[model samples]
Target: MAAANDLRRGMAIKYNGNAAIVLEVHHRTPGNLRAFVQAIIRYINTGKSADVRFGSTDKVELVDIERKQLEFSYKDHNGYHFMDPETYDTVTLQENLIGEGRDYLVENLSVQVLYAEGKPVQIEMPASVNLKVVESAEGLRGDTASNVTKPAKLETGKTI
Candidate 1:
């Protein structure tokens, strides 16, 4: 258990009977009123976000979360797969769980996965990834006047 004032971004807590991660937190004190903490939390199960307020002294249930670096193996009918390099074990995650990071996934790419109570909760992609262009279009002649850009397909089937 922890006080509401101690809540910080990326901290996992049990809220509303579900495991939620703190997305944002702000401590506010209104004129002639006591200080309170306002937070935005994202639920791990439903992938829904909510705004909640709590008194500064309120008690909150903190969850134990673990983060691991795993390598992207492949995706198939089961789901997106990642391998633990140390143990050579693979874990398959669903497409929804991968979220926007799927666009950046490539073979042997390193990614961080967050687990709560031994269950995977979230995936964190690196700040940036470099991918090889598999297909691209030829630039038209005299089309470089403005900041023009062309779409290119990466080896992972993502277009940019």
Candidate 2:
């Protein structure tokens, strides 16, 4: 257990009997009352978000989360599949859980998946990822100085 004041974004904690990841946190002190910590949390199971408040000194249950470095194998009708490097085991995750992270996934790309209670809950991506461009339009001759950009399709079928 830890104080609510210590909560930080990306930290998983048990809130209201359910496990949730802290998305945002704010410390506020009202002019007339005691200070409290306000946080925006996303529930892991349902993918729902909620705002919660806690006293500065309130105790919050911290959950132990496991993170694994897995490689992106492929996507199929079932879902996105990732392979454990060491065990060579594969796990398919639902589409909803992959969320926007799918935009950066490519074959053999390494990513960290967080698990709670032996269930995959969150995916942690690196600061940057290199993706192969499958399709791109020819650059305009004089557009270099104007910061022009063009649409591109990646090998994973994601357009940017």
Candidate 3:
């Protein structure tokens, strides 16, 4: 069991019969009342999301989440595949489940895979990924002093 104050961003928790990730949290204080924690929760099962608030008097259970560092191997019609460096075990992560971070994925890049109840739930990439600029214009005018930039496509099919 854990208190509402224990909540944090990216911390996994249980809500309304499913797993949820803590997106944002804020504490509110009033004149008479003490304080409360307001949170934005995203449901992992159905992709339906919502916001929830937990008062100081409210107590909830804190789930233990385990993350492993693995390398992204490849992708296909099946899904994005990741391989464990130590065990050589491979797991497929669905595209839909990757949400908005799909464009940042690259081959053989290390990612943290979150597992709950022995089931793979989330793949976390670095805040910023280093990708080679694959489709940028040749050059504005040689490598001289140029103070302008233009649209470019990264090697991972993402626009930079």
Identify the candidate with maximal TM-score. Answer: 2
Question: Pairs clashing in candidate 3?
Answer: none
By summed lDDT, the worst window of 10 consecutive residues in model 3 runs over: 138-147
- TM-score of every model versus the real structure: 0.75, 0.81, 0.77
Q: Which whole-number lDDT from 0 to 100 does residue 157 have in model 1?
A: 89
User: What lDDT would candidate 1 get against the real structure?
Assistant: 0.91
Q: Cα RMSD to native, each candidate?
A: 3.4, 2.5, 3.3
CA shift of 56, model 1, Å: 7.0
Please identify model 2 stretches exceeding 4 Å from their true place: 27-35, 45-47
Stretches of candidate 1 off by over 4 Å are 1-9, 22-59
Query: If the candidates were sorted by their lDDT against the true structure, best first, what order would they fall in?
Result: 1, 2, 3
Candidate lDDT (C-alpha), each = 0.91, 0.89, 0.81
Please, what are the lDDT tens digits per residue for candidate 3 over residues 44-122? Answer: 6665668898997788776678999989889899999989999999989988557677898888889898876566667
Error of 2 at 61 (Å): 1.3
- TM-score leaderboard ranking: 2, 3, 1
User: Which regions of candidate 3 deviate over 4 angstroms?
Assistant: 28-35, 44-47, 138-147
Q: Which is better, 1 or 3, measured by TM-score?
A: 3
